[model samples]
Target: MIGVLIFPDFQILDASGPISVFEIAGRYAKSPASIRLIAAEPGPVRSSSGVEMLARKFGSPSAITTLVIAGGDGVEAAARNPCTLSFVRAVAKRGTRVASVCSGTFILAEAGLLDGRRATTHWVRTRQFLATYPAVKLEPDQIFVRDGSIWSSAGITAGIDLALAMVAEDHGEEIVQKTARQLVLYHRRSGGQSQFSSLLELKAPTGRFGPLLTWAREHLGTRLTVADLADRAGMSARHFTRAFVAETGTTPSKAIERLRIEVARSRVQSSSEAIERVAEATGFRDPERMRRAFIRAFGQPPQSLRRSARAG
Candidate 1:
C-alpha cells in the first residue's frame, strides 16, 4: 500500500499529483497498488487553495510500502506536532519508502530522517531550510534527490516526477511512460535536472544588467569575457565584476557558463547536434571544456544526457 500523508492547508497538487500517478501506475503494473490518504487528525483537511481531501487517521503502517508526505502553509505546525513526528519516525523505522513533496521535506528533516542525507525541497525555501537544518546535505539545484530509502522533490509538480520515478523502480520504465502519458505530462524530468533556470538565478531579471545578460544569451557564440561584458555595460572590468556578483549572487564567469551550459543542454537533448558543434555554438569553444562543465553541473556528459533524453 502507498500512503499519502497530509495536513491542514497542504498544497493540493503535492498530494494529488503523486496520488494520480500511483493510481494510473496501478493500472499498468503487474500488481495493482493500494493507496490511502492519511493524516494526524483525520477528516476533511483544508488545502491552501481552499480545496479539501478526506483523510483517515494514521494507524498501523505495516502494510504501507511507500509513504508520501505533502507540504504547504501548515508544514511548520505539522513538523512541530509530536504525534506527527513520532508517526513519521515510526513509519520510517519499519523500512517503508518515505518521500516528501516540496516543503514536506521539512517534516522528514524534523523527524531526523534527513540528517547527513542529501535532500532537496522547493527552491524558494532554500535559505530557510539551510538555516533550520544545517546538518542536512541540501542539493538545492536538483529536481529530486534519493538517499537510501528517503526521497525528496523540489516543489509542487516535482512530486509527480518523484512518484513516477518510484513507480519506475517498482514496476518498470514502460509503466512509468504510460503513467506520464495518462497524466498528460510531457516527460519525466531527471532528478539531476536543475530546479533553477539560468535567468531565474539572477536576483533581478529586469534590473540594470538584465539587458546585458539577455544579449549575452543571444550571442553565446562570442567570447563573453568580463572585460567584454564590462565594456558593453559601460562599466570598468573591476566595477562590473563586483556589481554583477552583488546583483546575481554569482560571478560573471559562472553566470556566463551557466547560460552556455543551459543552451548547450537544450540543444544536446532536443536535437541531433554534435557535441563539438554544441560546445562551439554555446561559447565553450572546446568540446573537452564543455564536457567537464557538464560533468560538474549535471553529473553526466553530453552524450549521456542525450541518450537519456532520447530513451525517455
Candidate 2:
C-alpha cells in the first residue's frame, strides 16, 4: 500500500499528484497498489486551496509499503507538531520507503531522517532549508533525489515526477509510461533533471520580448545574433541589448546560448539523434561548441546526458 501523509493546509497537488500516479499505475500493473490518506487527526483535512480530503487517523504503518508526506504553507506548523514528528519518525523506523514533496522535506529533516543524507526541496526554500538543517547535503537544482529509503522532490509538480519514478521502480517502466500517458504528461522527468528551465530563469519570460524569445526558440537553427534579434524586435542593436539585459538578467548573446543549450539538451536526452546533428539544428553549428556549452550548463557533456537517459 502507498500512504500519502497530509496535514492541515497542505498543498493539494502535492498529495493529489502522487495519488493520481499510483492510482493510474495500478491499472497497468498485474498487482495493483492501494492508496490511503493518513493524517494526525482523522476526518476532513482542508488544503491550502480550500479543498478538503478525508483522511484516516494515523495507525499502524505495517500495511504501508511507502509513505509520501506533503508540503505547503502550513509545513512550519506541521513540523513543529510533536505528534506529526513522532508519527513521521515511527513510519520511517518501520522501514517503509519514506518520501517528501517540496517543503515536506522539512518534516523529515526535523525528525533527523535527512542528516548526512543527500536531498532536495523547492529552489525557493534552498537558503532557508540550508540555514535550518546544516547537516543535510542539499542538492537544490535536482527535480528529485533519493538517498537510500528517503526520497524528496523539488516543488509541487515535481512530486508527480517523483511519484512517476517510484511507479517505475515498483511496477516497471512500461507501467510508468502508460500511467504518464493516462495522466497526459508529456514525459516523465528524470530525477537528475534541473528544477529550473532556461525560460523560467529569465526574470520576465512572458514580458516585453517574450514573443521574440518564442520566435528565437522556434528558429534556433538560424543565426540569432543581437543584431538579428534587434531587427526582429524592431529596435537598435545597442538599445535591444541593454533592454534585454535589464529585463532578463542576461545579455542577448548569453540568453540565446542558454536557450540553445536548453533545446539541445532536451533533444539529446529524449531522442536518438546524432550529437552533431543536434548541435547543427540547435544553432551551435559546431559539435565541440555545443559540447562545451553542455558542460558549462549541466556539468556534463551531451553524450553523458544521452547515456544517462538511456540507462534510466
Per residue, candidate 2 scores C-alpha lDDT tens digits across 1-312 of: 788999999999999999988888888886777899999999999999999999998878687789999999999999998988998888899878999999999999999999999998886676588778879987766778999999999888889999998988987878889889999984455323332533455334587879888888889999989999999999999889756644543457767887888789889999999999999999999999999888767777999999999999
Task: Kindly give the number of clashing pairs for every candidate.
Answer: 0, 0
What are the lDDT scores of the predictions, listed in order? Answer: 0.86, 0.85
TM-score of 2: 0.68
TM of each candidate vs. truth: 0.73, 0.68
Q: Say which candidate scores most in lDDT.
A: 1
Q: Give the alpha carbon lDDT tens digit for every residue of 34-67 in model 1.
A: 8999999999999999999999999896878899
Q: Report the poorest 10 consecutive residues by lDDT, candidate 2.
A: 190-199
RMSD of each: 7.1, 10.2
